[model samples]
Target chain A: MWPGPADPVQDLIDNFADLDSLVRVYPLLLQGFGLTILLSIVTLPIATASGLAVAVAYSTAGTGVRRMLVVAIDILRAFPVLVLLVLIFYGLPFLGLRLNAFAAAVLAIALNNTGYFGEIFRAGIEAVPPGQGEAAAALGLHRMRVLIHVILPQAIRKVTAPLASNALELVKTTSIASLVSLPELLRSARVAQEQTYNPTPLVAASLLFFALLWPFARWVARLERRALATGH
Target chain B: MDRIAENYFNGAVIAAALPAVLRGFGITVLVSLSTIVVGISAGLGLALLRCAAIRPLDIAIAIYVDLFRTLPQLVILVFLYFGMPYLGVTLSPFVTVVLGLGAVLAAFSAEIIWSAILALPPGQWDAARALGLRPVPLLFLVVLPQAVRLATPLITNRAIAITKGTALGTAVSLPETLGSAQSAMAIMANPSPLTLAAALYLLFFIPLVALSRVLERRVARAG
Candidate 1:
């Protein structure tokens, strides 16, 4: 009566928000959800630490070494995370280094994230006034001690917003691991959708992602606004 | 080193795969450009509508922006390409990628543009009004240009970042650069096409990255 074949609302409900299929797919989605979180937790620290280390080296290195580091960072940053993932996952076997899908996803994402975090750390470090370093040096602090103890605290504070933003990006980026069959949340949803001949699982997965990420997104937005207000 | 070059940088495999990779590069460029155009325009429209400050409309726009911002583009693409058919609405992979990435980009750009508009001095609006410019004319002639200028660097960065999602089109088999390269790698039993694809991506994106850096510096100087 309402349309050509059936009610549009009912069709949408059955296709998108069907509770029965959602319930059936919940277990698989839960497993994938855990893996997604695990991937983020594992990759974030490795990326951040190595990226910070690079930024430190860049600050201390000679001009030639600094130029080489900048070139490498730019190339890595310019490379698409997904292509890097594909390259690591599919292209690495040729070099006789085979990684499983999960390891490849983590490594690829870490590499990409490091490029970004390195740039952020460099900017943050640069933002600190030179006087601060001189003051630390005049107090007989070693260069590394000044950087680690005095300079880094201020640098990290200045860049917290960007760091959080990049972390959020990393969490979202984990979904791409699905493409290489890592059985993450998105992949699990796809499997369930195929099995049930329904899209409800996909909808559920998106809801899960939103539920996990929305708060973080809002926090990043708030941090950005505050940074803007502070004239950063 | 020599073996690495032979395996990944094979001259013959690259030559064999060049045509398909080029075709895919074309699709990648088409998708990226279409996404940029759609995203920027739609975003501007949404931001303009937002300027009206109607309560329900503002709420709806906020929800749209937040929802799109929260969901990953690949999830949206997968939903549109694979899930929509169950509801009797099907989009081709190309449309799906464009629509998904474009929608996400639109959300981000809308927020950036809206913030830029808000950041404009109130005096600008008052001056436009005093000059006898009607609301639409004031917005178009005075307000929007400033807002667009303020928003340009940010919108450019976000656009580049989101448009990189074009690589995700491989998931739905859109046969863009990465997809074609993957297929070539499979067929030629070498990863040369992937290497070539990486080089192509680097060539395209490095300039944009450098441009973003320049724009960022400009903004910092202006501040």
Candidate 2:
């Protein structure tokens, strides 16, 4: 297809950057990309809210409740998110609770992130000085009001950096949804690569991820730097 | 409950799957250990080189670190294992998993150690220089130890996370823990092997998770 005999550079272009294959797979790639974004959007809030709930419970609960929370968090954290996803996607049906691929992926990821975000939120809550709550109570605020109106806002702000970092992690992790036949971006690229016998789609998908994620990564770094400079 | 036990926790299936799963776990250990060695050393090496701080080299290293940080390990593995054959550089599944994960871990380690070095008070360098220690002696004796201590907790957490990615090797058909259990499931037509695999992973990783907590506490206290 080249005007002259093929060279190494031409071979690489054909193999990894073949425009014809890229065009063919572009629609499938877009569909998968949309699902990836959808998964991330759906997961982030559920994980953050649920994790916040868990953290708040830990803070206010009795020792038994605290112990149970810790055990649950530790177990979830110990299992690699991939393994957790597999267990849920495959093992749930045996118990007669069948979840579709998207639901299964969301459940597994949300569960995993709940553990991580719980810890992050717990740390954020603890970082709020005790005086903040005392002063709120002194002002006649109810305990729940003190927690919601005073402490939580500051706690979430304090944890903004880790929150963003975890969010980035969640987006990247959506790739694993492909493993369960979810046809997310990575899976779509795999399908395209197989169908076209060219790997260009994989490269294109990677570049797409890098483009989507790099700015947020840089933002997280800046946040981290600000957090470090401000110091606790 | 009985049905759940029969499908997922059957004793006979567990016993039958145990041997293959154990063999796969052995491979997991091998791959993880070797990847750790390669990753940490290469990471430390890159961090050390970055300390020298030539502009072009620093930019190149930054790009490498950022690229790896952003790309998922699975994507990298897929590229290397499947795409690279087209470029005349096919890698075995074992090599691909090790190299792919090692590269990612190295990126993280480099960042952690670099930041740890940056976190060190400048006085240490000034004091070491005043003592007549050369750059090499100064870095090794004075700077690196403190930086490494600071970096250790973060690095340990990241290493555990990345090494757990050995299960990702199943994508390339590396017969690691997850892969073996999967095939065993196929042969036995039972999901019990997967249960065994999860148990095995929990057995290996839960302690490490607990240890990381301890390390985080110790480091915080020391600081």
**DockQ list for all candidates:** 0.75, 0.62
Error of 2 at A72 (Å): 0.4
Question: Which tens-of-lDDT digit does each residue in B161-208 have in candidate 1?
Answer: 887889999999899999999999999999999999998999889998
Docking quality band of candidate 1, CAPRI definitions? medium
Candidate 2, A9: how far from true, in Å?
A: 1.1
The most accurate candidate by DockQ is: 1
Which tens-of-lDDT digit does each residue in A116-216 have in candidate 1?
Answer: 99988987888889999999999999998999999999999988988998999999999999999999999999999988788899989999999999999
TM-score per candidate, chains pooled: 0.96, 0.95
* C-alpha lDDT of all candidate models, in order: 0.90, 0.87
Q: List ranges where model 1 is wrong by over 4 Å.
A: A1-5, B127-133
Q: Chain A in model 2: its TM-score?
A: 0.96
lDDT of 1 at B134: 97
True contacts kept of each: 0.76, 0.60
- Provide the RMSD of all predictions against the true structure, rounded to 1 decimal: 2.0, 1.8
Docking outcome class, model 2: medium
Can you tell me which runs of candidate 2 are displaced by over 4 Å?
Answer: A1-5, A225-232
